[model samples]
Target: MRRNDCFFVSTNIFSTGFCSLRKIVRWMLVASMLTSMPVLAGKTLDGIKARGVISCGVSTGLAGFSAMDSKGEWHGLDVDICKALAAATLGDARKVKWVPLGSQQRFPALQSGEIDVLSHNTTWTLSRDASFGIHFTSIVYHDGQGFMVAKKTGISAVHQLSHADICVQSGTTSEKTLNDYFRAQKMKFRPVVFENFEASLKAFFSGRCQAYTTDASSLAAILQRETRNPGDYLVLAEVISKEPMSPAVRRGDDEWFAIVKWVVNALIVAEEEQLTQANLDTQKEHGNAVVQGLLGNADDIGKLLGLDRAWAYRAIQAVGNYGDIFERNLGSGSPLKLSRGANRLWTHGGLIYAPPIR
Candidate 1:
């Protein structure tokens, strides 16, 4: 029988009949072999697969969130998310291109298709969601705006520096937040702004400003790595605004958004099940139903997302677990040493939680 005749007789061809016999046969063959091959209706995932690398946007250098080593290796919480997505989709953690983006450039890069995912330290606000043609997938870090000052300045509280000169990075929520904060408090201050984060840190170090104001996590990072004297600076305890940092993707791509969102959930689920890269091989046979679903041992959770049964398994093995990613990048294992205060798992009295994979 002719190839077109074969597809027609079998009723396997899509309702929208194809013109070419060769195309019809190839589609049937692919369908038979890979039952769960993802439908790439959103061109973003297909583009990443075609290019053999997922372009991930990240901060130029934000210590535990996103930074580069002397050997040009990317490391941080944001970097791990990028790698995890690569591992889940392409089965290779290293199949990722890191695009270091500034605060203002990150969204534009994602919108322009320059990056597949923006995992930088970006706050999710109502205005950003409504204005930008972007969708925030999940909040990876719970943060807040705060102030940092040199210890010898005798500044202990937000109101202490009423007439202080503050260094802030331009084109960031921090810049505007800084302005609104002092104005609301009925205080006066000089606003010293720089285009880039490094320049703001440089100015802060040189005494161009008496204080540096930004997210508390960023303040901790500066104290850890950017300062000549780590002990000389103190991060104030007052959190001025809520900053929920999340990974964002261009809106209108439901498939790509699900892939990124589930990759993050896979990490958290792996951590909850105590499934580490070292123990994943054995844990696939774990008696717990949720663990079985997550490890692709039973029900094959990836089928729902049109991925291979082992997609989540590969991601967990590549990046260990969510806790592993956190500790390695931002906690005691790294320079930042940030305590997992609100970022801890729900079982441990923190907010990190994931839905069931079944």
Candidate 2:
């Protein structure tokens, strides 16, 4: 053999006595890469499958986000997220056990394994994300902290509430943001905090406090559902803090986290593709490659998350896309009648965007 020739292997390993140094190095590198790849154990998913239901934590009672109707059926944007997750994971949207939790109880419930996922409208901040032993999956709603006062209070602007009494729910970012806003303006105010959401709303509506503070979306819901006369209350024009509401899960379960994250992304992607529950079947039949991939007709993306091929299809068939959930729960279809605003898709000049499914 010439000095420049490369060694060829036969069926018998001993036949290739001389091998190229480059080939040996390449094989060693491939082996190292394969060994370093992380294995997904999926313990949380196993538990959920074993129980045949997903335990989802939601707000005690926040209209438009999470609330139970008179019939005892839960409905809201947050509730739909759990439904989508359940549909994707278990092939049934109704296979979720909703656990109503207060602002203070949400984190503890998630940390204690009392809930598989926290679908409550909780804000994502650096401190909580770093210290809470939980991971925020995705920002489902773009919100802001604002004040809601009785129309008769004559408080039209946020700055006008200087030295006023503010009613806020304890153990929430609303309480802290209210203080920061007032202190930043060199003003003083009294915080009348309540441990329960209903109590805080009652305190504000009953004139116990001059202003009610919480997420602006929550304020809208309270005005529409809680108040006897919606016109009697007004949400101020000034928004104080950015509240990016997200779903969270406990740490140490990368597999479960990815499942939750991608389930949400799948909703957004469906909206971007103009796919809805009504047209999903038709689109699956005559749609493009991306749509086919999402519906599991082309690419089997579900297996990457340890799910079956039709995971995304089941989710969309159950709750529709992100836009459908938003409109039905928080937008014109619901009493809130709030515009998409910052929650619209990025293609439509809003902040909502998701990674590609394929």
Candidate 3:
């Protein structure tokens, strides 16, 4: 939990140096498309094949989300997606390079081709969808903005805190959302915004601010990992903003989008079919029409993506199914212990639904 370790990056490496993520994303968007058709014209798949790995940008350190183990192996829901892309492209899941990026630097990294995809827990916004010239694929997680405050403060609801200081990570949707929520409610509060999330969180926890504002899932993870009085903190029930987090790829490349999209969709679809990593081998050979098609025995979808028919199979093998990832990282298997809630598939009464594979 440090400043530079949070989201701070040198401005010299980005467009306009400081205070602008959109500017950097814009400039890189133009560059990524310049020779995209040549190097990746027919080579999107070949480029990744030749490069040997897929480079993806992720958050600095959010436990059970996108963090490194002692051996430097990356494992998490988002991390698995990147590995799956590598498996689909290179036929080897470990053939991936993890580019640790802070919240603001993530999109720019994707546009500049520093990474093939942005896997940070970034919310898909309208402006980001249109102006950034990038496509967000799949809602990997459904979340909402919330506030975290120490229980010792005896403040049970956000409405009870008047004139309380709040800590927030800069360059996140939290900034505008926090301001709008507080101002619209006519509350008085001081904002202690920092360039890095750790700085803000540390400050807030250390009494620099009365509360920390971020996505509810993140606040829960932070509490689960860092708080001694984990029960001492309360996440206010107010859901201020809807955060549909997903991975993003550069625009103007429809095929590339399809490949990434399908790779993601495969995970969700596989979960629906009960095709976990443990059971994929058994069920992949099942005679069900959907199973055969998804496993590449029935169609040419893999050929278009520059992958073998079993690309989806390889993806599920690398990362398991969507439910496996959820249970392992954010659900029953992990420390977070979060309920599926809105992340469940449509058939299960959740909002996340994938397109038909056929």
Candidate 4:
């Protein structure tokens, strides 16, 4: 048997030989350290705290989803998500730097650490989820592909457009979905593809294409913002493909993932509890126990994610609940005038549902 300063000799009952317990302990320690490397090297929350602001990647300008106003202020459904995340992470919804991203720039910016979160209206597909080293938190919007045509075209249904030219963005799920749909229906059409939505809008308006196809929500935004007479254009009744739009974060950051996900759930839950920002103060005093727990009154739910107890409360106050956000940005009051069809709460016979705060 040999003994050294770093090694210890021990009897091994299983081997009838000398064994080094110190060596075994050293190996276990190394294994433990190796397992924790990801956490130590890349703490997304710590970096966000250090920066004092969350860099949120958003679309260039999509009218109702994430667009810049005349005064260069970002406002929309997606922008509210960023504000909600900032409120949850930093206890201030305004602690966010909006990074305008084109479709080509979004994933690269996220992967390169240029943005803390991609709150853009990006779809959650299996290929994107599996191939890209990114994680989708939760679906914030339930959307589907649809077509918009001039009222004078007299085209009432999707099947009526045979041999027609359609304007579409070049690199998007909408383009692929359009092809799949037209092919499935055995319809022939020319795709007037453009590199960006602006160009597609211009082409569609210039009469270069008979129809403009994209997510139905986007079609409404385009018509409301760019059209001379929105009444002249009609969004069709058919919704072609499922587009489960969600927020995404860099992979391997479970703490950040949970925080983003729960913030969205908190919004939905707040709506369910009728916890508006105006009544938040009053509700905290004498609200129901479930609402109190959800608002972080009776529980330390925020501390579980390295945040203050009022994190969810701050988020709801900043952007209102999911329903309020939808209505203000994309619903009746907004230019889009989108109805809360699938985006309504579960209690209202829609798909929007959140897990319990407990």
Candidate 5:
């Protein structure tokens, strides 16, 4: 028999025959590896950490959700979600490179791995989930498609605006919602299409369109900032779509997706459990066991999400829980003053639920 590095020689009774122990050993090793190999694909987290910044995708400019401030500093509900991920992954909430993306481009950017997580105001629909190879995290905010019209139009309800000229963004859920509503209601209107919200606002403001339609949150932002008189426009009292705004990541990246998903969930969980920035430091010393586990006090739970144990603690310290972000950025404290109707906790008959950290 020939012996070399590529082949092994066995001297046992099986080795003497055609059935060699070396071949059996080879089969065993191959079988073992085949069964034990990792099923979930990609090294997404390590790639982001090595780059030293969490590349987050956000809306081009939606106020409350994501928008640039006067100094070009980004702040909003969606931005806070991304910052939470940075804290969970890198221990620094500010360790993020914000990538402003439009509606149509967000999915492609995520699928191509151009961004780690998308904090854009995206809806979690079944088709998007199944087709985009992306997964939705916690429902960060509950939203609905609606219309905002000038008060002078004398249109109190959404249906009352007959032959209304509407400003709408192209290639968005807003477009679909607008079409469906008009079709169902047997109504006719001129849809002034624009590629972005800024242009839509311009058209609507100039009377090229009598009304501007978008997500209710976006309408609030556009009203306060873009229009001549914020008070002159009113959001019609009809929600046309069920929008569960969430963060999404590429498919087959379970570990990485889990990290991103839970970072946002941890905020909601933290808030529901009454963990806050002011008392988080003291609570770590001695708190409820559930709160301790969630806040990463009793365990290195943060490390499990590609962050230090105190990563979640730092996030809570920086921005706060889901409610806190909403309250400060878009709630009564801010100019938006959006009500927490569908965004409240399930106990309060809303959909803001989070998984247990344990």
Candidate 6:
């Protein structure tokens, strides 16, 4: 029979009551085979491999999220994400070109292919996720908007700042949230907006504005690192809005998107498996089934992500797990000294959770 005749006959067999059990089983087997096929690597992965580096966009300087130290080395929670991606894709965590971008430049740089992925401390919102030509991989940090004021101001609460001048960075969600909050409270305030993150902080510290508003974690960092005396500033208890910070990549590449998404998931899974950089090699040899799968010992999970079997193993080896990243960058081990309040694993009564590696 012709190919078209065969296709029509096979499709109509079920409706015509001519289908047999053997044919049904054959179709099911074919479906299973098709579903088990490996995913093809996309152009983004191909370009990264050709160039031997992954271009990553990060915040200009935000302590505990993305900042440069005295040695000019970038170290933060977001920087670690970029390193993990580099390790998974290029087999070397150092094979990354870091592009520091301001608030307004981050999205345009990612959209224009100047960067393969954006690991900046960006909040995931409905409008940005749907409207931008980018896909948010996952929420790596859960944050909220807050206010900071000098202790001498004698302002203790959000309600105390009625008709006050608030310092905020322009082209950010914080600016919008500040307006929304005050308008809802039936109050008025003068906005001291600056395009640069540093300028905003400078203006606030110089007493140009009554309060400085941003993510609570960022406020803590600023208070610790920027202020000469940290005890003089206060982070208010009022959290105005939910800010789920996530890394994003340009759209139109499902394979690249899946690779980025699972690389993050692998970090979380490593944390759940109690896998750390120090003991990763030992666990690879004699760990449990889940640990073995994560370390590329039992299953070829990396193949499904268009990578080698040791993709996740290399990522964990380079940056450790999610918990390790958090502790060293934002938690007690770092200068920020921020608590792992909501960024802890779900089993510990927080929101951090990942799917099974298998």
In order of appearance, the predictions have TM-scores of 0.86, 0.87, 0.87, 0.87, 0.85, 0.87
TM-score between model 4 and native: 0.87
True-structure lDDT of candidate 4: 0.88
lDDT of 4 at 13: 46
Which pairs clash in the backbone of model 6? none
Most accurate candidate by lDDT: 6
Q: Which scores better on TM-score, 1 or 6? A: 6
Task: Itemize residue pairs with steric clashes in candidate 3.
Answer: 151-232
Over 13-59, each residue of candidate 5 has an lDDT whose tens digit, in order, gives: 44567466678888999987654332247577777778989889998
Per-candidate local distance difference test: 0.87, 0.90, 0.83, 0.88, 0.82, 0.91
Ten-residue region with minimum lDDT total, candidate 4 = 5-14
The list of candidate 3 runs beyond 4 A from truth reads 1-43
Ten residues in sequence with the least summed lDDT for candidate 3: 35-44
lDDT of 4 by residue, 1-358 (tens): 3565224433234344324666788899998775544344348889889889999999998877899988989999899999998988897888999999988889988877778889899999999998888899999999999999988889999999899999999778998999999999999999998996678888888788889999999988888778889899899999999999999998888888899999999999999999898999899878999788888889798888778998988999999999899998999879889999999899999999999998
Error of 1 at 64 (Å): 1.0
Ranking by lDDT: 6, 2, 4, 1, 3, 5
Model 3 residue 5 CA deviation in Å: 58
In the range 1-358, model 1's lDDT, one tens digit per residue, is: 6988988876755544554676889999997654323222487788788999999999988888889999999999999999999999999999999999987889888876778999999999999988898889888888999999888898999999898999988888988888898899999999998886778888888888889998998888878777777888889999899899899998777989999999999999888989998999888885488888887888877977767899999999898899999999989898889999989999999989988778
What is candidate 2's TM-score against the reference? 0.87
Assess candidate 3 and give its TM-score to the true structure: 0.87
Off by over 4 Å in 6: 1-41
